[model samples]
Target chain A: MDLFEHQGKELFARYGLPVPSGEVALSPEEAVAAASRLGLPVVVKAQVHTGGRGKAGGVKLAADLDAVRGHASDILGLDISGHIVRRLWIEQASDIAEEYYASFTLDRSARKHLGMLSAEGGVEIETVAAENPDAISKVLVDPAEGLTEEAARAWVEGANLNPAATDQAVEILRKLYVAYTEGDADLVEINPLILTPEGRVHVLDAKVTLDANAVFRHEDYAQYDETQPRDEREEAAHAKGLQYVGLAGSVGVIANGAGLAMSTVDVVNQVGGKPANFLDIGGGANAQVMANALEVINNDPDVRAIFINIFGGITRGEEVANGIIGALEAVDIEAPIVLRLDGTNAAEGREILAPHLNEKLVMEPTMLDAARRAVAMAAA
Target chain B: MSIFVNKDTKVVYQGLTGSQGRYYGMLNRDYGTNVVAGTNPRKAGTDVEGVPVFANCTEAVAATGANASCIFIPAPGVFAAVMDAAEAGIEFVACITEGVPAHDEARFFNMLKRDHPGVRLLGPNCPGIITPGECNIGITAGHIAKPGGPVGIVSRSGTLTYQALYELQQKDIGVTTCVGIGGDPVPGTSFIDCLEAFEADPDTKAVMMIGEIGGSAEEEAAAFIKDNMSKPVSSYIAGVTAPPGKKMGHAGAIVSGGKGTAAAKMDALRDAGVRVGLNPTEAGELMAEIVAEL
Candidate 1:
């Protein structure tokens, strides 16, 4: 799960990283009060999940209370790359002597935590990679051994930072690694690990994506979950422990696995139809899970037809067919249903649903056939 | 010959005392796999499905001469269980447990590489491997895959793995073995590893690889296919419609920083002379056509 800038700063602060004192504000009035609390000349930044916030005019520096109110009012409702800002982060403005980039991400090829450091910061890392690739220094951090102090020192020197900032840069990198691992984060990036004019290092921004699977170990993550905005249908699906992503389309797709489910969505689109949502029932589909999926899909008024694709591995095809029959009985579904069942006992499963096949309950042989039929039904 | 398992592989179930363990344990046994022992510290000396339960991997191996293990332990206990299996000198371990933390996976994977040389790890969150009529080790249904074929299958997703197998079965094309390399940021076995094994296996003629949006594994696999693989390879990459920056159910199924997109993977595979499928069924059809020619 991705955290907003203020939330990430709070997490970094908890991990003992040097972040400028900041307060989250919800409204223009709150922004004024927060600025006053932090003394004056604060920075009012929009809290959105997307990047290029500064370019989108969602970030502004204010000299006094009136400017703070104006910037806060302007940015709070501004849209930055399709994500609207509902909140603002008011932080005390700092003097910057130099800026550097540091981040930790999983390196799939190396199978280790990758730490990238660059003296050239305040820009896209990709730009650095494309224009001057050697500017960025990289280290593969072993999860077993962790990022030791010596390793951090070596990384700092490798990046070719200003010698005056080496001690402070290494210090912040050490704490940032702690925040990354102990906080169960998938990524922790400080685009500008700035060295203040006062000869101190501080994080100018924080971007962290926590590992959702590791939520079981952290209770404080409950607050983060509460702040995440989900649509009504998505929230309901989440409540039922279902994996769903709502899309603006006509056909509602329900498949057995993630890869297959996404493919089902792609196939629907390929057949001259748009998929309304992507839903995976996961392995071992049962009547209850089927019912929940149907109910969620039914709630979408844009859905004109439903595509149910099942490849029974551990869950037999016959049981899935029965589960669909059972779920249809329990839920009030408006869209016509088309199912393509295969794998273990698929023929037997097809036979069981043989009597129910019709205009409303269509059963196609292949995935392509089922998708074609479903697209036609939705068009009809 | 198969890449991973055959009828001669003496197997032990790690979480045999649990309900899931009992089900797949008996299923593998009934498939004519030489199911020899089970492991449960609490139920030592007890029998599950007539398979003797041992106190640990060491005892199970000593008692039954088991060379392989199928693990059903939960995610948290996985590292130790894998270590235990390795300590007992089991050369091959297929873990079916899902949702293991990436840190745990990285640590254990590194440990296994360093401490236990020559040990093979299949998955921590995958649908194990299957060798058709000879032996069924993982969750792939034995009926979906038949024995004595010329094709080999390796995939990242479990159900997609089965779907590819089912498509082959429909075309009367049997497989030598099918491997699910698991869906995680860092899996123990990779497409290149499986491809190497399949290329070396005499019974295997062609191969199918299923990848999703996430990581550069497919890009690397494309390089491997171009350089080393002599066998014909068909490919299908999922998450073409998946929105960037969203994890599509699988932990490894996300496209970050404009990377790991289906378009990129398809381009890489096509450039490597792979017959890329637009979807799972199409990929299967492509492979079936390739194998028929062979």
Candidate 2:
């Protein structure tokens, strides 16, 4: 789950990392009140999950209460890359002597936690990486060993950070690593980790992506879950405990695995049809899961046809066919369903479904054939 | 004759008392795999339908002479189970549990690399490995797999692995081994690991790789194939129509930062002289052609 700026700062503060004093404001009046409380020369930043917030005019420095109110109101409804700003993070602006970047993420290939420190910050790290790769100093720390104080100090010196902020930067880097590991985060980044004119280091911006799988360990992560952006269909699907991604196509796809579901979407598109959504039933092809998936897709008015692709592994084809039949009975589906069943006990599954084959319920021999039929049904 | 498992591989189950563990354990045993022992501290003296249960992996390995472990533990207990298997001196461990925290995977993966250099970990969220008809582990349907030589399959996706197997079965082609490396950010094994094994195995002739958008494992595997592999390879990469930044069912199947795209993986594979298939069926066909020529 991706946390907003204020939320990331809140998490960082828990690990004793230095963040600029900030207040989360949900409205223009709240923004003005926050700015008044924080004193003048506060930065009103839009709290959205996307990047390029500054370029999108969602971030503004407000010198007074009036400017705070104006900027807050302007940014609250503004869209940055389709993510609308619903919350504002109003913070006391920092006096920057130098800017640097620091982040801890998984180096997947190496199977270790990678810490990247760079003197050049306040810009897209990707650009800096592509333009001047040597500017960024990288350290791959084993999760078993963790980031040490000496290692962090070496990393700071390697990045060529200002010597004046070395002590504070090393301290903050250690704390950030704690937040990255203990907090169960996939990524914990502080871009523009600024050294103030007073020779103190502070986090100016935070981008933290927590691991969803680790949510079972942390109960407080529900607060972060509430902030996730989802449409009505996605919200409904989430409530049903189905892995669904809403798309802009007419063919509704339901498959047993993530890869097959994605392939089903691709095949639908390949056959000149768009998929309405990507829904993976996972390993289970039981009645409840199938019914839940069918109900969710049936609720989408844009869905003209449904493609049910099942290649059973642990789940047998007979079980899948029975689940689809049970789901059809449980849910009042409007769209036609094209199913292609294969793998274990597939003949038995097709035999059971043979009795129910009709215009509304159709079967195909291959996945490509089923996709073509579904696309044609959707077009018609 | 297979890369990882053969008839000689004595297997033990970590969560032997659990429903999943029992089901796959018996299935594998029935497939002619040397299903030897199981581990459950509580059910040490007991047995699951004939397979003896030990208190722990060390005890299980000690008593049954088991060198391989198939883990069916829950996600929360998976790390400990994997560590237990490693500590018990199991050389090959395949974890079938999904949703294991990435941090746990990274720690255990690195620990195994450093502490137990001889151990080969397969997947924490995978369908396990099968040396077609000889030995079966994890959840891949055994009846669909044709047992013989000349072909090896490795995939990141589970059901896609099954799809590949079924596709090959349709063409009357046999497989030496099929390995699912899983679709997680940090997998225990990579495409290159399986490719390297398949390349050295004399029984395996050609290779079929099913990859999706995620990490650079496929790209790296492509490089390995280009530089090192002599066997012909056919490839299929899913998520061609996947949108950027959206996690496509698989946790690792997201196209992020304009990287790990299907187009990029396909291009890499093609440049490495791999017969890239547009879809799973086409990929199966390409493998069939390779096997036919072989």
Candidate 3:
């Protein structure tokens, strides 16, 4: 749900906000062409999801086309926060007279939308919040009333902005709120909302995080490429309709729900074992899904052992037992598995699993026992 | 003696024509809930599981006189569904639907605060509440909850509720009512809301509150208990020292600025005279020890 800076600027442009005109390019030639079209004095920014790109040498202000080309080539494959730069946004540089910060996000405690504004921009707001808390002004907006011009003006004054920029700040705040709400974004941050030497307000940077749950409504909001090579095991699990998120280490986990998957991870870590992945088969589970899950884990070269924990309610325990047996036959898994099944037909499920019981296919009545056994097996 | 729901409460379903709505509706009926009617704009006049399906919450409320509703509307329709139920004068609404846009929920929350102040909204992503042995309204497993009185349960996780209840039942501690507040970014009620309700209920001798990483709800609730409530409360905030910025149990569980973290909430509760559990299984034992001391 995190948008790259270039993507966020695209959204900002859609809302009629003033942004330095820019084009995203993947190559040095493309970057040079983009800079030429935008005229001289362009900023080449490496497009990655994480912040602190400037400190990482991922951003450079090019005075001419040659500098733009050089910076673009250097930033094209630069890695920032584990995300490699695949594109560069070349934008016209503006002379800033002032820099300000503004953001809109949900204030959960107040149960309202919150707007944060600060006269000091282009830096981490946390530092300001910690040292000079008065510099940041927070407004809890009533969603029904929406973000009105009056509220924006009051907020700008509350942030103690220069009196000259108050009216312009208010106008831009209103537009930002509209963009934030209409964009279905969980967060919209504009750092260095610049006041150019010409006294025109322009967005220097746009950081947007859209709510993933609402993505179904925004068809044009393409799914993030995840922009990294996915674990082959997880990719296979995804193909089978199972939610799998891989982590480092060697203990593979399979649980019925997201909560259980997380708890399983915690329990494993508590007992001194690192979980290799978090896999939720969701509400419905049977031999086929179970086989798919086991195959996914088996495919992971890092997995040293497996753990299957199911507190079945609507999902039958016997069905899970059948899955264990079916999966053992379907895939050649060398790692040990510690299984825990509880709830409806649990006795029947355990009985079915009894025949397959071995060091590798173990069953435990309690979560602690299963966790301990999985950890021990993984350690061995 | 329970807070929001009991045996006599008649429940209706809004957006009940959908698969999730009918699924939970059937389970609610099985758990002895008085599921009288449902509402669906498209499937109006039809019956889902022998219950009447009206066109809207108002029409359903008028016809069935159902004072409570369990919603299963999709994200886009959640706003209208909640407002519809509120305008129709439903006293309690359990919004089981997840993924409501924060802005939409903010609008709905503000509307409820102003227009329908008397109404109690449970969740926008929350699992519904259950009065054990009486009525079940949300998505927690029915088989795990045994009807009894003594413990009042509140949790942020749907699965953890089942785990906690199963553990409690093993120790002969039956629940008065279990509320799953749903770990959504925007919830209708805070952890303090359920804590206060449990604090005042006569049948509930002790309380078990399960929280997770993300928000400062547990810290705020713990502060409230310290200042106001005299009831014995035991708590557990999940994801103790979880890696910063990673969501553990729920979508809403994120450790931003380390504000709503397990360690922080636990510290706050410990300083507030509330018993804190080291793990999910210890929550009931801690509650038992606190109640025994009382």
Candidate 4:
């Protein structure tokens, strides 16, 4: 869902928004060649999925091609906020006459899309909103009408931009809004929308993050860098086609719904247990999904015990128990599993799970008893 | 006596031909919900659990005089289903489908305000609602919820609500209605919206609100409680002081800029005169204590 700076800039350029000419380089040699081709003064930016790379020393200007190579070498494979820099975006450096910031993101309060244009650019927008809120001009875009050219112009004018730059700013903002909405993006940011010494405006940086749920409509958007290694548990879970997010701690959780998975984590913590991961077999407690979940957790040495809490409504309890029994047979799971299955065929579910009623696999009648037992067992 | 669906509410099930629709529709009917009609674009004239199935929402409504709808359409077609439900004059719609795109929801909200100002949407990712002892339309455990007096439950979490209710059930606490607003980024109804409905219900006395980390919905609900409701309100915020996750919970549960955390929501609720539970286990006891104090 997060686009690298180079990818965001490509979309911006497609929309007729001015962006610094940039090339994505994978190796230090390529970065050096890109700097040489762009002619000496270029900016080498480590492509990561986070902001404030400038403060993190991930963004640096190269005075010469050799410097560019050195910076690229240093930045490549560097970790910024847990995201490893695998690529570098090399852009032709610009001489700024004036710097401004512009972004369009959804505003939950207004229940409409919001666009913020600020005279002060190249700084965190939150800082700007806090210190001098008046400096940032904001406009709420109607979902029906969208961002019109006239409305964008009004926003630009309100930002107190000079008349000459106002029209150009308006044009760029309108295009950016188009990129935001049409592109299924939740955030479209052009940080430091710079007016060059040549009297032309261009986007110095692009940060566009698309909504993941909308990615199904745009199949091409699903292409991502798969080379980066994920947590072993997460990768194992995903391999089985399960949506699993691993967390730190001892209690491994298996819940049916997304909301249930989150609440299970919370409840685990509340009962003095630390959760190892969040695994939602997604309303389907089939043997495969349960096996997949257990395989992911079984791989985790950190998980001391497992909690299988099922409030089966649409999903039958017998099916959930069958999945658990199937997972236990499929994997060499040593950790204790405390289960609480209620609703629709729960008695049958308990009967199915009765065979595994050892210290390692216990079934309780209530959620609290299960939670208490699971936490106590995990600690042991 | 309930906020949304009761015994009299005539309901239509969208996507009634699907396996999910057939199952839950039958279950709802069994729970005493008047499931009058259903909609499936391909399965017109087919009966699902004795309810008439039409080709679309308009025909279903026309045939059955259905005033409420429960949607089971997939994510891709959810927008059109919601639009159709609105156009068909369904006063209340419960959307159980998850993973609706934020843009589509934005458009849905806009269209609702423009064309169907009267319709109230329960959720796109929610578990729907249960008017205890009347009818159950959502994904919550119906057997756990008993029709009774006073307590009103609203939660952003489905499992936590069930667990909290399980705890409350131990103390013989029963609810008038239990609504799971879900943890989607763009929910159809919010915590504040539920609070307003609970406030208006004469049989509802104490209110229990369960929220997780993410979004300002809890804060908004707290502010609403501070200004309005004189009844006892007890709240428990999940994920208290949680470490920032690799990814946020659902699309809706992201705490950025030190906002919408469990601690922050608790503070807001405490400031608003609502009793804030230290943890969910204490939530029911807190509700009882708050009611006793009142």
lDDT of candidate 2 at residue B278, scale 0 to 100: 84
Candidate 1, residues A1-380: lDDT per residue as tens digits? 88998889899999888899989999999999999999988999999888899999988999989999999989988988888899999999988889999999888898888999999999999999999999999989988788999999999999998888999888888899888988888899998889877788889998988877777788988888766767888888888888888888999999988878988988998889999988988877776888889899988999999999988776667877787788777876889999988876688888888987777788888889999999999999
The best candidate by lDDT is 2
Question: What order do you get sorting by lDDT, best first?
Answer: 2, 1, 3, 4
C-alpha RMSD of candidate 4: 2.1
Arrange candidates by TM-score, highest first: which order? 2, 1, 4, 3
Residue B117, candidate 3: alpha-carbon lDDT:
98
Per-residue C-alpha lDDT of model 4 across residues B149-195, encoded as one tens digit per residue: 57899988766667567656767778888888877766778888889
| Model 1 lDDT at residue A24 | 92
Candidate number with the higher lDDT (2 or 3):
2
DockQ of each: 0.70, 0.80, 0.51, 0.50
lDDT of each: 0.88, 0.91, 0.83, 0.81
RMSD of each: 2.0, 1.5, 2.5, 2.1
Q: Give the residue spans of candidate 2 off by over 4 A.
A: A345-348
First chain of candidate 1, TM-score? 0.94
Give the local distance difference test score of model 2: 0.91
Candidate 1 residues B180-200, lDDT tens each?
A: 998877798999999999999
Q: In model 2, state the lDDT of residue A127.
A: 93
In terms of lDDT, model 3 sits at 0.83
Error of 1 at B65 (Å): 2.2
**lDDT computed for candidate 1:** 0.88
